[model samples]
Target: MGKLTDAIKHLIIINVIVFIAPQLLQLDFTNMLALHFPKNEHFGFWQYLTHMFMHGSFAHIAFNMYGLWAFGTPLEQMWGRNKFLFFYFSAGLGAGIIYTLVNYYQFNGIYELFINAGLTDSEVLSILKSGSTNDVRVVNAITQDQFNKITSLFNTPAVGASGAIYGVLVAFGLFFKDAKLALIFFPVPIAAKYFIPVMILGDLFFGMTKYSVGNVAHFAHIGGALIGFLIALYWKKNQFKTN
Candidate 1:
């Protein structure tokens, strides 16, 4: 416990503080800090970093913090504080970028659909701008409007540290490939290298297949993994050159 890396310690502390601040101060800190995808119009450039520290619920924070503690301390120890922080923020930022791009494409598709269905340009623009259609009748009456409203919410904010944690999981897999990890409350043990990738692939499959799971940003997980893998590859190449 005392051997935890400074990065991990500070991250845990901040997450805990953010989690409890709302209850203590009676403010909706998470909603305010969460990363609203670029299309939100309300999105700011800083949310990419801020959202990783904000979580929606107790269970959400618990799972994210647990993943961070389980995987992050070891990676931080190996990579050192500055490198770990860099990798963490990089992964989180990458996640936000990928999520925003995906949301933009989806929003455009919906926008085009609404336009094709004879909804006025203003109506479509209103949905894109505010994410509220204001009339369920319009949605029910026009299939395209329903689709537009549904996809508009996709542009809503994504809040949590899971993306960065997923990046840590990737780093752990690469550096501690043979380390055994056991699922929480389960007796089965699996190697970190294989386990983490499998989990990532599972997330990809589910993310692609299921779109209705509200507020879970699975593509951001993929984005984190991709960034981690690329960073690891770059370090390996540079190490070879240095040697």
Candidate 2:
């Protein structure tokens, strides 16, 4: 489409290229690029930025890149290249930060339970290191839930651009409040101001209830949307002053 701006084109190109490179080249980008939990051995500082370019499946990358092109083009046209790039990465980093904070709280809950179950600090650390406890005493001290949480916290790697795309979606809604949107479930179009909030609420419900059908990162979506909203709101308020 003629509306596809320069930055959006490049962003989509890079994402698709990186998404295919791993499979075609047999290179392992998951460990180096996907966002891993902070305590996980695969966690690295670069993951915050790199994770935005890594996706798990064809559907995952396709939908995210589509969202970027659909929503990001106008934002890039309005903000210019440098500012648009800054907003994109800033929203992504913010999404990662918030997602990690939520994970930390979940981990702390398990940490307390493990402590109460009589696992020593070192024993807990060992479990984190090895991703499991062979120690019978440690195994018997807690419910199956504890083990599952510990395993999930230490081993699950999040890979996708959904968080950052959610950011772009939020920005689109804010900038084009009256724009009509249609969803797959609801073919009838509605104004973006109404639709985006509903979408975000759906994600919140899913995240809080753990209502995912698979390995979905609902909170990351919420995080990106929130960050995008704040950034767009701030810019809206200060636009006159900046100009």
Candidate 3:
């Protein structure tokens, strides 16, 4: 909205650094910093926090940082640095955990199908890891589509601050419910209260269905919004007490 506050400035600087440093140095931080499937070998505990700073592409980081600055500026100004930091990180962690839980459910459902078809644990793991099932029984038990989904889920690592940015967007909506906003594709301005819920619903619809536009982690966005809403609600209700 105006010049960045201290926390907002520092957060943007860190995100930019994380985005640019690896490319400049020709270093790969995907396995170490990007969030991966819990069952994947490359999965790391620290990625839940670190992945918030990692991004897949320039457009991805640009959008996220812009959201952070645009929406986060008011919140940081209202809540001050420490409180804003707590809310931001809490939403991000919630996003990672929720995303992982959803993946686990889907992965295990497919895994159970494999087990029910008489494949052993090791055999199922082997098939998932190798992305091939020569055994007639395994092939007949699960369709190629199912095999591909589980494999892609296992191998594709999630990066970027979209989750945290989604959290900021939600908070912005709550704080400035009447503020006009619009998406790039749909530029007609709408009140934040109306627009944000629609946005989140779109994510939920895409996350549960097969129509997701890109390699987006929709559930992460949902998770962050959920956490942001709860925290912002609590703070709003207890505003006098906190102050």
CA RMSD per model (angstroms):
3.3, 2.0, 1.4
Q: Candidate 3: where are CA atoms >4 Å away?
A: 240-243
* Residue 142 lDDT in candidate 3: 88
TM-score for all predictions?
0.85, 0.92, 0.96
lDDT by candidate, in order shown? 0.76, 0.84, 0.90
- Name the candidate, 1 or 3, with the larger lDDT value: 3
C-alpha positional error of residue 29 in candidate 2 after TM-score superposition, expressed in Å:
1.7
90 in model 2: Cα distance from truth in Å?
Answer: 0.5
Better structure of 2 and 3 per TM-score:
3
Q: Candidate 2: give the clashing pairs.
A: none
Choose the strongest candidate by TM-score: 3
Error of 1 at 155 (Å): 6.0
Q: List where candidate 2 sits over 4 angstroms from the true fold.
A: 128-136, 240-243
Pairs of colliding residues, candidate 3: none
Worst 10 residues of 3 by lDDT: 234-243
Residue 151 displacement in candidate 2 (angstroms): 1.2
lDDT winner among the candidates?
3
lDDT of 2 by residue, 95-143 (tens): 8888888988988887887787788887787787777667776676766
- Residue 115 in candidate 1 has what lDDT? 67
